[model samples]
Target: MSNTGLMIFDGEVLRSIDISLPELQHNITGAQLLEISESKVSKSLSGLTLPPNLKNAAVSQVSDGDDVTFRRTEFNQQQASEKLGVFISAVADTLRDAPVVVSVLDGSMLKMFLEDEDDFAMLAENLFTDLDEEDKGKLCKREIRNALVHMGVDMGVPPLSEFPILDDIIKKHDADGDEELGQAQFAQLLQPVLQEIADVLHEKPVTIVQNVEIFTGSRLRKILADEKTLKCLVTKTILELSNEKDSQGRADPIKTLILSNGKELGLPPLSSENEPVALLYETIFSQLNNRDKQTAADASTEDGLMDSLKDILRKFEDLLETAPVYSATNI
Candidate 1:
């Protein structure tokens, strides 16, 4: 699975935030955390944006209705930071634990198609012709299931896998029987079956978790803006390189580092199997090679390596800004 843009509260993301230490030194209240407005907290956060769908869930987790600890509490800078960090972490946890983003199949499309007389007539005729193999005017009632499949999910019909009610719906119409049906009988069976599906969907919309890679660069941009966080990342990368004994290659270290940490930095997962991501890396690395011949040599030092990583990340950000990627997930 690809990384989700939704923030999964981590120490790294919490540390990246730049909050006013002094502002949080006063006596705190559970109702208002550190005098920080939701908007301010949101802005201070790095590498995390709370999407609208998740706002309510996050807010609900921010409080537990117990204020005994925070009432009339005065804390030092470290304590204040810790307190605020706890709250932020809770919000992130809520978002992460909540369901992945989903699309609701509420039968609106099917209703619209049914409402249009010309469209429904054409659709029925087409389905009849397709199912009537051997050019026979009649078809087995079992073909009604095929008709439903022909309509598919695009017409607001859920897959049998996603919506098991479809089987029951088909059975209710006796469409499972082998009784022969002419064009009119087939259309008659189809219309009511579709109508019933639409009614069921109207009562309980099917939520489909789309498998997609959303690369808006918002998280990446936030990470890039946090100088302290960038410095910390560089320092950690250097230590990892030293421990792994991976200093021989020029740009290879950077490439490996990025491929490993791209998801954390809000880029799509980079692997050989994912062509779009692979091509992105190829293009960026190609440019890096052409522009800086001494990149390999520069990897010997800390500052030089940091500069190279920043450059590569900036290229990714720019590219993503121009063309964001999204895909539908099958649940």
Candidate 2:
């Protein structure tokens, strides 16, 4: 503290940083200003020396979610560390009355907290503000928004004072949902991901065995590759799930169950489960609503045929009531 002496107000560095002759008396706890001149102090202020460990401290405290991507490159990580060190050093060097503090943190904890979403999102929002206007668009906005949403917006993006736009965006997106979730929209969201997963399976052939609703391994791969149909179904499932009476109450769990059940409820199981029964109900109801369409096309042929199919579906439903898992062959 003595290297560059200054008179501070009430021991706060920022309150009064005067480089004139020392003004208070009876303070022997710290360094004495002695006879230092204003010119010498001004020269030292221009120099702005910081503690050597400043960068290390800043690097240690760096949050993981700002897309810093420490694993991306040694150079990038080290550079960030150094730049942060400079900032910390600058603060430490200037603020004589500041109390220095640091905490020991685990890499695992750092990684987990970073991914906790809501917490990271708040951090990203701050990071967003710190970035240049152009830089804000690329890394900050998307990641922060995603993190904010993924956390379920429980408190509605804490530090709400920051992102005024998020509330409106969420409301708008919710309000604008299609009457039913669109298959095309669903396909677009997952198609690329499924394709990537499928590419890995080409090397080792495997079956796309359906497990309830989960598509394990090779099936998952296949679904990713040729998922135009499944994606559409998934989208519709989501839409219906949204419309479900319980939708607003427990969204995540309900959505998860809806998707899991839908993924397994293919053409084979439709005859048994309410999923198919429900679809049939809709189809039958629509047909009943449009007597002209029923009579116009193939009422003499298709109408009775549809009745027989409905009876067959009823029998399948009876069989399905007793089992946890059922297959088409068993039905």
Candidate 2 C-alpha error for residue 203, in Å: 40
- Please, what is the whole-model Cα lDDT of each candidate in the order they appear? 0.65, 0.33
The lDDT of model 1 is: 0.65
Write out the backbone clash pairs for model 1: 210-329, 211-329, 250-296
lDDT of 1 by residue, 91-184 (tens): 5565433323434567776777688988888888999999887898999998988888887655667679879989999999888998998898
Angstrom error at residue 253, model 1 = 2.2
Off by over 4 Å in 1: 1-156, 159-168, 176-209, 227-229, 239-251, 271-275, 327-331
Encode model 2's per-residue lDDT on 67-86: one tens digit a residue. 24432333333343343333
> How many residue pairs in model 1 have overlapping backbones?
3
Model 2 global lDDT (CA atoms, 0 to 1):
0.33
Instruction: Looking at model 1, report the run of 10 residues with the lowest lDDT sum.
Output: 1-10
Q: Give the TM-score of each candidate.
A: 0.48, 0.15
Model 1 C-alpha RMSD vs. true structure (Å) is: 11.5
